[model samples]
Target: MRFALNHIATPKLSLADFLGLARRLGMPAIEIRNDLPDVVGTMPAGAVRAAAVASGVDILSINALYPFNVWSGDVPARALALVDYAQACGARALVMCPLNDGTPVPHGDLVAALRELVPILRQYGITGLVEPLGFPVSSLRTKREAIEAIREAGASDVCKLVHDTFHHHL
Candidate 1:
């Protein structure tokens, strides 16, 4: 299997520096986080793309879009923007987390949310990596729940579960 490191590993490093380290360490891929100090989210897409090309490192995925499913009026537009950003950055997938907004989102609502978002993901040729946060307030707390939502949304081809080990044990 190919090895990949999350941007969290070197939060303060520039994208170019991080890519250099990944190449030196022989990692085939790296996950970029929009929240990182000096990286994709803040940098211009051309710059990020240039850095990735120069380093010869494959971008596996973008770290995340918060409460991706239950998007409000402008949230879906923001998500689309992120999807475009991911595509421009040569990233294959967009990681999406369930609602962690401290309100209990019903299972039906969760399914509805996924249904609404999956089409947007497919339109951009982006994979939706649904991550379940096992927090008490999180609507989705297990891979099974995410899977069920994907199934319910009829988006199995575009939506997949992302099991975060740390959250899985919580």
Candidate 2:
């Protein structure tokens, strides 16, 4: 069996070091992050792509666009930017996370947000992995809700579920 690493697994490592670690550990793929070490924020997409190529690590996804349930403020812009980065950096997908702050984002709103994101994600050839945060306060608390929203938005072809076991069992 093969395995991949998430950048959060080594929050203290530099992006270069993280890539190297993945290689040493026999992990051919990895999930980069926007938080903690924040590779997306600190490095250029080209540099990230180059480093991953150099290390022979496939970029599975970018850890997330937070509060993706709401398409307001700069969320749309941020989603575009993240998708652009994922494409430029050779990542196959963008991990789209929902609001986790106890605010209620209705199913209609969730579907609307997914619809808005799908076209952009398609343009970039990046799949959107909707990761429902299962915490009690999370706006989206189950994979069923995420899948329902994705289907309602007609995004089933481009959007997928993360199905985090930790969150699923939470």
TM-score of 2: 0.96
CA lDDT of every candidate: 0.83, 0.93
Q: For residues 1-170, what per-residue lDDT tens digits would candidate 1 score against the true structure?
A: 56788888889887888899999999979899877653655887677777888889988888788877676877687788888988888888888987786887788887887888888888889998999888887878877877888998898998888877767676
lDDT of 2 by residue, 74-150 (tens): 99999999999999999999999999988899999999999999899889999999998789999999888888899
Q: Extract clashing residue pairs from model 1.
A: none
Models, CA RMSD each:
1.6, 1.1
Error of 2 at 74 (Å): 0.5
TM-scores for all candidates: the values are 0.92, 0.96
Predicted model with the maximum TM-score: 2
- Pairs in clash, predicted candidate 2: none
Q: Write down the worst ten-residue block by lDDT for model 2.
A: 161-170
